[model samples]
Target: MSDRHMICPPKHVAIIMDGNGRWAKARGLPRSMGHRKGVEAVRETVRAAGDLGISYLTLYAFSSENWSRPEAEVNDLMGLLKAFIRRDLAELHRENVRIRIIGDRTNLRGDIMPLLLEAEETTRNNTGITLLIAFNYGARDEMVRAMRRLAAEVAAGTMSPDDITPARVSASLDTSGIPDPDLILRTSGEERLSNFLLWQAAYSELMFLPELWPDFTRETLIHAIERFQRRERRFGGVTAPSLAVGS
Candidate 1:
């Protein structure tokens, strides 16, 4: 492989974009302004990831729990989503970015579903970076859905109970084709998974940054990548070579 291809960049990186509201409040601006700025950060991050050779970038866009927020906020968020797709779809397609969404579609607002579907269909054939958006997603809910599918298969006599395995379950997830993330980052000083990729993130390196989502820049992303590179990932095993030092 060429040096560019051999560079040790994570194959997949997932980010939880948090603290838009906090960022706006701190600046005495409307939350909507913060969300608007966050979109700019998203654009920059996507470009940086593609340039860095990261193959997959999954962003936690909106959780299912976010529906419980005030109706006005939800409407504004939905509007932003629609605007993003309408405005950026052509650019993303030209850049060869494949868009994928992982979340329940049932009961979605009539107009919203079509936009999400359009984004996926338009970029389905792209071979460049895959941008997986976790909209209306919850990790526990995803697990339950996967388990239910497995149970149905077993009940139909097509598969036995013992035939179920971790691999099978993973294949049933919305992210079946995508590789698991090597790094999962959350901004704004929060340090929790917040129900994102619970099964796939079993071994992901976590990074929590103090910078809010709107303030995240390319440098911040580079720093996070540097931090990840400095760590040793043993995948639940000790480093064999290191163990021989004292012998």
Candidate 2:
């Protein structure tokens, strides 16, 4: 590690991988090809995260809104996801990396659900970096689901509305055990959260890059972290006295 990387690394990092269709369009290739290449980016980013000593890495793989796409495209995405898990699960497990899926799994296709469950179950005891794939996820939907859990408890007389603190609500979330991402990054130069980790990104440093997902590299990851380390995160508090002139 160089002195450049000696800065404190964030405990959790999340990425919104975007622009697959655009990448394919620009390359005159099928969108499916872009998605396949994006999978390669995913593998590289995961390895980069581990090398950077990040404890949790969350990837916005598939959103609930993504189901609205054409059936063929959706199937292609599903197939790619399955291929990734089946091909890489063993290697990831051997690396002592724990796999976690954070999203709505209740309505997943029969074939996809088992693979996700198996991935999690297989590496449940690993004591290393956690890779959280957010498939079928939308931040609003996540919050809604978390709210429903609390509401059900209230209805059952196990809790009251007044007891619903931020901490309590967080515990009801799908990412209950995971820390909030300290850095949230998006690709393709898009500057939007796009319903990813809204609840969990209260204080995350956001970064947007111009590179398409398929073109992402470890160098991009390093550059982002270098930028992240230069930020002075106060988390909505004053860390020191104001030094502004004429204050």
Where does candidate 2 have its weakest 10-residue lDDT segment? 1-10
lDDT of 2 by residue, 46-129 (tens): 888887788999999999999999999999999999999999999999989999999998968769989999999999999989
Runs of candidate 2 with Cα error greater than 4 angstroms are 1-7, 243-247
In candidate 1, list every pair of residues with a backbone clash: none
lDDT of 1 by residue, 1-247 (tens): 2223434689999999998999999999999999999999999999888888899999999999999999888899999888999999999999999999998878998598899999999999999999999999999999999999999999999999998999999999989978899999999999999999999999999999999999998778888988999999999988877687685
Model 2 TM: 0.95
TM-score of 1: 0.95
Candidate 1 least-lDDT 10 residues: 1-10
